[model samples]
Target: MALPSFFVTAGRRWLKLALALGGAAIAQTIPAHAAQPAAPATIRLDYLHTGNATVEQYAVERVVIEPLPWPGNMARTVDDTDRGVNLVEVVDKASGKLLYSRGFSTVFNEWRTTPEAEKTNRGFEESVRFPKPEHAVTVRILKRDENNAFTLAWSTELDPDAPDVLRKQEPSALRPIPIRVSGPSPDKVDLLILGDGYTAGEMKKFEATARRMADQLFAVSPFRERAKDFNVWALAAPTPASGVSRPSTGVHHASRLGTRYDIFGSERYVLATDNRALRELAQNAPYEFIEILVNNDTYGGGGIFGQFSTAAANSDWAKYLFIHEFGHHFAGLADEYYTSPAVYQPSGTRIEPWEPNATALRDPANLKWKKFVAPGTALPTAWPKAEFEAYSRDIQQQRVALRKQQRPESEMSALFKRELAHEEELFSRAPERRTVGAFEGANYEAKGYYRPQMQCLMFDRSEQFCTVCQDAISTIIDLYSRPAQR
Candidate 1:
């Protein structure tokens, strides 16, 4: 019914600043308008997701009552956007009414597509959180079948009042500092920025980096235009070491979050494998979205929709990495570039992807973004594909050689700058540079899949989101916060 008292007790300076900005204070947990009902207690279900490419299984580990109240808008409890590889649905047991539902992708789903999944079975920890219900409910996880339609994969009945449910927990040593407090949590999108691999001496640096990244996120639209619809909170636990593990480089260090580079053996792919450690620390704050900042200067980051996104806080291109990876985590936008090597094996069959950006273009007449297409524009829009691929191939080789040679991070950063310059020059001369039409080479394939534009943040290091991507992101913003006034 109230914000955890530690928020005020542990961060006095931030509390005072929040109050000065007329943001909600700890004592004023509810909105000033008393008519709004208090948010329900937050409930988290921890589970183990295990399997290989051929088979999978899910099992409930435990249910927890998070310290903070639910931060989501009660008015909009069901997700209609239809993104992600899996969906979580909570149904009232007695009446069979759907009380809450959300779509999310997991590390397991990403892993299953890799070659390793074919050889051996492995497991990943996963968690789903919702507002606690008064009575028994059926929690079902639906997975996409071969046809890309949702099919029930696992289900369990849960009772919130059960004696085994964890109703309390020890207070976390880390306390959330209010970075940008727009309003009450339920009325705004609460984004929690977490820091990993920062020592006690570097906590101040971590906060500054988190603040900078949050600012970078809002500098882009529609986040820029709808900035008032969100709140930002930051928290970090001190680590014994200063940087996270980069196994490929033979550098290893322990951190509160088990985040490390060389995920799936890709040098620049960073991710936290320990989901339970992440969830435990995050429960201390009221958050709907999370972005983890790792204390490393390497060019690496990873994101999974509805889980979390990670960015290198000390990279030369940290701002771009932060916003670019956040695009995947925040809106379920697929990667548009294809030249870079990835861990996942190519799919033999092309099914229409559920992500908002890329498409198989199976039905050109009814392209998902047809409304944005110009009247006479070609379905598979023309672009300089041949030339672009030729150039990208050379750049990819240089990128690989730099990492293989153990070159300095600055050299890699310089190469990226040059690559972006070439891309911009190439795109400028193209006839359909600004056109909203299907461009070949997307979703990590040189053919079959198409993106909506010639260049976008998802496609390259460019700063702007494509028109189609902007629309997709706005839809999600509206779902979590109040819709824009007509």
Candidate 2:
């Protein structure tokens, strides 16, 4: 009636592997006298999101069983936050019972807004991951319509135990290094910080940079207050070169992740077009969220909700870039600043965005974050808009001239510091600068859109998020991990 010696050894090996995934803190949490919940295999559905401005389509490419077990909290399988432009739902195919769901945004959604998408079709490789199911299920991809209603965009039947499913993969030497271990992954928010453009010799440097940023991230509100509810991991496969490509500056490198600047014709935008490469290296880590750090010194980064975010690790504003982009990726918060350059062509109509922060303000009486707004504050809150616009216009001109003349990155950094200082001084004098009043000139528009606060980390190069943003972020934290005791 006793287990065989070989079987006992194999069970011990699996225990070690699971412990390694969580590091010392997690391993210690497993009591010697208690039973542990069985971890399920991670299931990933890879597909293509192809479309233009007017239409979109999805097609399944493959199904994969990742090497690591599911790290998400099985207790919180349903997402009720109601964020993101798209949602994925897994349901029992036989009984029509919802099994799991999560809201997410895709690169295809961002590209559809670009001018190039108006004239040509583009495709982005995308993937949706979830805990493997017990039986055959129907996977549904839902998209929001103009009125903010979700409709079934695509659906397919899937069998987790299918013979053709990709269950085996060649082992890679890469393993995630524990940057900060707080608890077991299922009970904590597991964040993976990936490094691109880092050489094998710079491995230590990557760890240092990732650790520094992770510390900084926890220093901010919401994250700061709930730091113990999260764990941080760092991973990178050495690249042949030391920096990612900056095509706008005519400097190109063979970065392993295909991350580069000049995305969508925006000089400062950075993104990784190679989703497969990004996901492959990422699966080696136990993570529910990812923030990639590029070793380049350029002022560029990008984030897509449910996909990932990238940040320039060596920029003067690297810390700010790390959190701001992560805001987009983590909470689906929208940018509030209107003066920055962008690649998307304006649609000129203000429709309510699904993002929690920005608003169309068509119904001012029912502002999305009205609960935070003080009574009697103007709906289209008045501020020194004219002066701010004038200053921003001048800064934009100087910014263009600097890039055109090939000015040093230091010069640009200094320019940004000066600009932020000017705005801080200007807004500091306002009586309601910190109040949660709807402010015009958000969503990259000079009009028709509003923001919950006059300035925020999403609005400017500020250090902390506004009260409304903080609340929004806190909501997501509650969804991922248990609420911090008051």
Candidate 3:
């Protein structure tokens, strides 16, 4: 993921200019950042992504010079892992040489799949961040075409020294609490735990919850093995209320990040669409990833790759929620479950999915995760799909009824526990449970799409990731943090 070394001398020259402009003034505002070697200043490009189901467009918003230095390893400035729905390339304008690149997904793209997009157009604010380059750069946004190949969607020219660039930002009263410090910012994966719907008086509780969630996340595989390569920070802007909005229940609260449930009419879904507010709060901390904790007890959460994830901090299944959603946000792992209703409409033609875990089984001879498949394992691996789906249908019905009756959160939690137990017993008996072959019924469809295993965190409330998911996560971990010394 390293950027080409040829631009080192030029990068350093702009790094100095970045420091002079506003980096020096904002130094005192940074919290718990260990002293490290000089790095380039962070530049963010904000824009409006407007579209409907059939068409989309991108327009430039103002550019901003963030308060912090680039928190990623300078050596690993480019992203080779093609995981997200969109890819960004930063190229030197005059030389046309690639300087930096990354893969990420946006709320706008996700919305395009929903039925609402077919009915009416909508716009979402989005942003992309990278290190400041020495020369004028052309920022190109590439999106997946019909065949899942990255095609240029939009491109814009940027000049760092332009007078219109936002060079200064007002200081934030909130200070990020260092939850876990591994090393200098540039050397480790920086994860910012932002809290929404917590009052000023509940800041201590927010920190405790953030720390607990971080511990839970690392307890899972891959992350547990690479725990030392991460730095975790917690921050929250005090809100007047103690919980985020849940429109289905007619409950609403004013929160800093605008996180809430009932996104796209799915009662369990939660997300924050305010990109500006999210970036403004996150800029205070040195972060490459973010997970927002809402101070509510509802079993709701959501994640978008390379952007952020949110979890209901007080939910009984908070641990599962934190890890499962992170799989989507951190590594672009698609959901393996299909019985539950989703906000997105089903695709008429099931081409191969861009996610690492889910596949359309287009080419059985060259399945992406074929290396992990056993020699004699069948291509379309067999499992108790019928039994599992039948049970899931009943459980889903009960789940919907609970929300319809406005049942207590405790009832919802109990129902989930029962569902998990039944799935465990059902999947354990299948001979193919431990096999790594194509399992039918995944990615929100009961047919076409396939998953690598019978069970996984992406598939259900399982405790561990499937082999394919584990490898995918490890790839991302390596991208953000250096490998452990031999």
Count of clashes, each model? 0, 0, 0
| Candidate 1 lDDT by residue in tens digits, 383-461 | 9999888988999999999999999999999999999999899989999999999998899999999999999999999
Best by TM-score: 2
TM-score for each of the candidates: 0.94, 0.95, 0.93
**Cα lDDT, all candidates:** 0.88, 0.86, 0.87
- Candidate 3 lDDT by residue in tens digits, 181-228: 665566678899999999989999999999899999999998998888
Screening candidate 2 with a backbone cut-off below 3 angstroms (N, C-alpha, C), the clashing residue pairs are none
**Per-residue lDDT tens digits of candidate 2, residues 270-363?**
8888988988999998888999999988788988888899999999999999999999999999999989887778776668988888899888
Output the lDDT of residue 100, model 1.
90
By summed lDDT, the worst window of 10 consecutive residues in model 2 runs over: 3-12
Distance (Å) between predicted and true CA of 232, model 1?
A: 0.6
lDDT winner between candidates 1 and 2: 1
- Give residue 415's lDDT in candidate 1 (0 to 100): 94
